[model samples]
Target: MGKRLAIAGVTGAVGQEFLQILDQRDFAFDSIKMLASKRSAGKKVTFKGKEYTIEELTEDSFGDVDIALFSCGGSRTKEFGPAAVKAGAVVVDNSSAYRMDPEVPLVVPEINAEAMKQHKGIIANPNCSTIIAIVPVWPLHKANPVKRMVVSTYQAASGAGMAAMRELEQQARQVLNGEEVTCDALKYQLAFNCYNHDSQTAPNGYNAEEMKMVNETRKIFDCPDIGISATCVRIPTLRAHCESINLEFESPITPDEVRELLSTAPGVTVMDDPENNRHPMPTDASGKDDVFVGRIRQDESVPDNCGINIWVAGDQIRKGAALNAVQIAEKLL
Candidate 1:
């Protein structure tokens, strides 16, 4: 009720999620502006049960906005984030543009909420893949300094954008209609299929998403020397992402100790029981705020009992993007 806010890329997936979280939390805001690309301009969007017309994002869109959540893309954030700051609005950008900038804070509230206070007008939410990995890993990293990690992420098609989600849905429909599967939003048919390839394949084989998990994890944990390896795969799921994480620490870390530490950790739901065939699943985590972690056990591959294997999941659009950005904005206030 005191401040005005604007959701850039309001028509986009992350932007819509931001609006939903704000409404769900009953955030007190006097005014809400929804900004989107010109193509989506003049479209109608409803916030807090009120109909509002979406405006095309321009250099002047941030006027009188107290906070602007940017999720359009990195290029858009890089182009307009500073302008929003100049217009007197704090920007919580859900992109990689300013994440590695030494001046801009890349925050995951549980791991680095205090960093929000040091923002240079813009705070960055970590990458979706990184966000999911860190939720369950941070508490462990805090208790024991992680020496290294090797992770493989099974991401959702929705990570690409709403188009990818639609493509998967439409493709499945096509298959159901007895037609050939389409592969427009992805490199391969994502309808009831899985690809063990990176989000953006590199010459060396690792994808951009794979690198984000490695780089962003080190930055969030403040452990640049930690040896991190990652392989990111895209799955047919609509929303949530799953990660198989193997962490190695300086000392021998135990599964029991992890269970104790994570049992009450903030925003974490520990659901492990390999023998019972219980573990974190995307279906279970979808539309949820907390990150679900399970399959906790020691890894025999890493020596000294210093390694543990686990699986984790969370809604990439929520915790991995919108929710985290909103949480940071809340911290700013």
Candidate 2:
């Protein structure tokens, strides 16, 4: 029998993407419940030629659900996740609510699907940037044992949600038409301008977004000692995120070897072609499932050839969030 699926936050960007991914992947579901906040209840959404009325999400919403794909914000998840679990549904949450909890499994299915066995009714999705950066890194790490990683993320407006994406589009037109730029969805102007992530700055000077990449990488890799430093910035792109990653391995690993390792890695697509200067870009990665990887080269700063640099891009809303959660739900079946 097919499982009963519930999509929480159905009106939001990631929520809508969840619906698209489920169809694209042909996920088996006997029934699907479209849930959202009270403000969005009763709205109609059509999926696979069937129309589903958005229902108000509450503690009672999960009684018949077998798997709940939660793209709701952290607060909503905190209020309702346990209720869903208590009602006999497994939650694959995209919020940060349960990510660092020692008992909850922080999963990237491509890297560690086995960890799902430890879930106490809920599986936490890693941060978008972390997901994008680590998909291609895991294969190399398994072969050479990455000792450290230095990452700089060029995130898209999609990370901040649909409002931010609309703001970017509006700002772009206003700028080109000589209208005053407005800043509401984001603290600063995001059209043709990049800025540090708007997440709160921690005492250590790293913002929450950067720290999420640092902390979540260690947790997902199951190596509490792995050294990771990240600098996160929001770029003007509408979707997909790009990262420049420098890796230092325990033993010498060449760029070619890294390429060979990632070539067959699940969820990775290598696009390195220096002759044509073709490489991974957000434009190519938007709405794509696989992370595009390229610009493979040796990092000259580190001696013994133990260091290498690569660039990657992936859709933040697809593989990074909705698709990842849905993939975890697939394992449950």
What's every prediction's RMSD, in angstroms? Answer: 1.4, 0.6
Per-residue lDDT of candidate 1, residues 1-333 (tens digit): 468999999988898999899989887888988899999999999887799999989889988899999999999989988999999999999988999898988999989887777887999989988998888888888899888888888899879888989999998899889999878767788887788763567787777887787778888888899888998888889999999988999899899999999998888999988789989899999999999999999999889899899999999999989999998888877
**Residue 13 error, candidate 1, Å:** 1.2
Model 2, span 78-152: residue lDDT tens: 999999999999999999999999999999999999999989999999989999999999999999999999999
Clashing pairs in 1: 1-28, 1-29
**CA lDDT of each prediction against the hidden true structure:** 0.88, 0.95
Candidate 2: minimum summed lDDT over ten consecutive residues — where?
A: 183-192
Q: Which stretches of candidate 2 lie over 4 Å from their true place?
A: none
TM-score of each: 0.96, 0.99
